[model samples]
Target: MPLVFSDQDLQTHNTLGLPARAAVATLDDESAIPDLCEALSSGRETDAPLFVLGGGSNLVVAARPRRRVLRVALRGIRLWRETTTHWFVEAAAGEPWHGFVDHCLSQGWPGLENLALIPGTVGAAPVQNIGAYGLELDQRLHSVVAWDLRAGRERELRADECGFAYRDSLFKRDGAGRWLIVRVRFALPKAWAPRLDYPDLRDYPGLGSPTGGAGEIPSPRSIFDAVCDIRRRKLPDPAVQGNAGSFFKNPVIDAGQADRLRHRYPDLKAYPQADGRVKLAAGWLIEQAGWKGRRLGPVGMHERQALVLVNHGGAQSADVLALARAVRADVQARFGVDLEQEPVVLD
Candidate 1:
């Protein structure tokens, strides 16, 4: 059996560093999935709450688990090519996301560079359709292979079927639990040009971007390094401070509301989305609320990145959560816009 049930294991097993423990199991192999599923399902008769953990990066431990926390550990990568213009890549669900990103850059891919250094595993990406800088994981994901719990069979879902939206997907919708992602595939370009549509990219004089209609395209390495630099300067690395990257999704309101806020604030930043809703920066809103670098007890906003809520070494999960709730309430009270948290608070 690949399962381990311990009496007292170090709870530092999570990214948030919250004191949490679960009857744990690190998946041994892909074939072992069925047995594990059977075990997990049968145990639900006790009707205890069960949590499927991925990277444990974006979650906050609420109630201490009386049940098992199954750590999915599947790993590997496969590359494919249809023509000189078409290439593809497939990675196992349990692979580290940033490592996979490094692999892509090493192999000369473009779409994932802007998302470098993002914490978490591959399986978690589709849950929120992880995005950063100006690119989303959905842009590179060609399809996903999953194990359907209900039918007890595996299924392959194309990118279109993912129902991707701003920080959301079908996996997060009513279709959830029907499938557990086993492998994710990507369709990349062989003679690919880098895309530099984001402002940071535009500012770089010699950056290469196939996405841009004009500019002398540099190598993928150059683009990757530049993106890393920009991200390091902007976001807080969770290793230093406990945070799930951004604390909230950028509020997407109607154009009229955006214009209204813009005129009133005069300097409020809003980016136009394809769906006709304007995407306002949550960080900008928080900063406008004067919460930037503000500290209330151990729970406070990140000094460099206003979007992350960090624990100053000894703050409890509840402390972080209360702070988030307060910030959300403040933003809602001030702007008539409700701020939704990006991190999943298990409480």
Candidate 2:
């Protein structure tokens, strides 16, 4: 059986360092899930509502949670299989995402290099289709092993079966409380080509590519190093500053609307997507609205990255939320774009 604790202090569990408590259970083995589920179904255990908790990097918890929190602690990683053209890797849900990426790179697995330094656990990766640089999780995901909370059964879902779109997945939509992902598999191509089309890599001279001239291809390790360096410079360290990285999602608007915004704000940064929609940089919008480095009591926008909402010290979830609403309202008023929050608020 998984270990159970009553009235657990969750301040350390969440990245934002929010004050919270709940009836907590930690799962360290997959075989134990059946027994736990049986207990829950039989009403042998408390029948409180269940909440799945991972690394808590992208969460804002209320001061008090009356639910039963299930913290996934199972851990392992392996090269599941390899073919002439691709490698299949598997990781346990509780494995730290960045650590798994680093492990793959050390083993010469190249596909995940562009997603370095991202916080959170592997189990939570598919929830938001976590992405960075020029790569997204759906691009590499092979399948997901999840336990259906509602059906009380374990099932496997292929990449296509997972409805993935713009920082969203089945785990986030209708399947939210119905599934608990226990493991994830990734397919990485052996025939790899470095993706340097992103403006960050293309504009930065030290990151290579721009100065490499024609026909120069950077190694996977170099790409990984550059991505790590860039993220470290752009985002605040969660250890020193309490924050949910990138508090808002970049708004996707129609090309016509984007053109109008561009005509009004000549320096506006917009990227044309393959689907004809334009992705406007949320950080740029917030910064232009003058929210960067701005503070509201203890809650404030990060000085370096406006998209990140930080808790300076002893800030409550309400305070952080108030600041987020203010910033969103300002962006909507100025640019007519509704900035959706990225963090999952658990009250």
Candidate 3:
């Protein structure tokens, strides 16, 4: 049986610095996953929740959980397979996402370069379908190894089976707490193509992207450096000021709805989706609602980026939720669109 710690303080584990606790266990490697699963199986009738915690970058623990918190500490990365078309790279759940991306880059894998500087573990990446610039984790994920908590069996889910959406996955939706991700495998193409379509990345060199043609292509390393630079400039370090990166998902509204808003505010940042919907920038809406840099008790919106909600020292879990609710309500009233939180709000 894996050693379980009682009443462990989890403030240090979570990036938001929220004080929380539960019966906790550390999964040190893939071998330990079965032992942990067996233990869970033995306690099948218990009403207590079991949560697999990764890097804790994308969660808001609003209260001390009445649950078992499994801290996934498994770590490993290697080239699993290579072919003429693609390179298969595998990483254990506990490996830091950025570190894994860096490792892939060092090994000459270029698919994850645009996703640099994302905070979380590799296992958590697919759950959130983490995306940045023009790339999403689902775009590179070949498959995932996860333990079915209820079924008491291990299973592998391919990319198509994962049900990925913008910042969402089966792990987050239907499988929430039911499947514990153990490891993830990514497919990096041998034929390299840097995605510089995102405005920040496209305009990085000051020279505009060529119209109707492939422009001066940058090396993967340069794109990685640009992404890192932009993220560092835009986002606040969690160590300096506790935050969960972007606080809200950009609202996807229909063409008519988007047009109405655009007419009202000509400066609205709206990106048209392939699905014919327009994704409105959450930060812009929040800033327009007048919440940026304004403190509400121990919480406030990040001045540099309105999308980020920060714990401005001595914040309680309720304080954070209250701030989020207030911001959401204001944005909804002002823009006629619902603002959905990006982070998982833990009970």
Structural similarity to truth (TM-score) of each candidate: 0.90, 0.95, 0.95
Lowest lDDT 10-mer window, candidate 2? 206-215
TM-score of 3: 0.95
Q: If both were scored by lDDT, which would come out higher, candidate 1 or candidate 2?
A: 2
Model 1, range 240-320, lDDT digits (tens) per residue? Answer: 767677888998899999998988898888899888989888998898787889887887898777888776777667777
Q: What is candidate 1's TM-score against the reference?
A: 0.90
* Per-model C-alpha RMSD: 3.1, 2.1, 2.9
Report clash pairs, candidate 2: none
lDDT of each: 0.76, 0.88, 0.87
Best by lDDT: 2
Order of quality (lDDT): 2, 3, 1
lDDT of 1: 0.76
Scanning candidate 3 in windows of ten residues, the lowest lDDT window is 205-214
For 1-347, candidate 2 gives per-residue lDDT tens digits of 55565788899999999999888878888887787667667777666667788999989898987667889888999999999999999999999999999999899998998888899999999998999888899999999999887667899999999899888988888633467889999999999988777778666555544455655677787788888888899899898999989999999999999999999999998999999999999999999999999999998999999889999999888998999999999999999999999888777
Q: Count the backbone clashes (under 3 Å) in each candidate.
A: 3, 0, 0
**How close to the true structure is residue 207 of candidate 3, measured as C-alpha lDDT?**
31
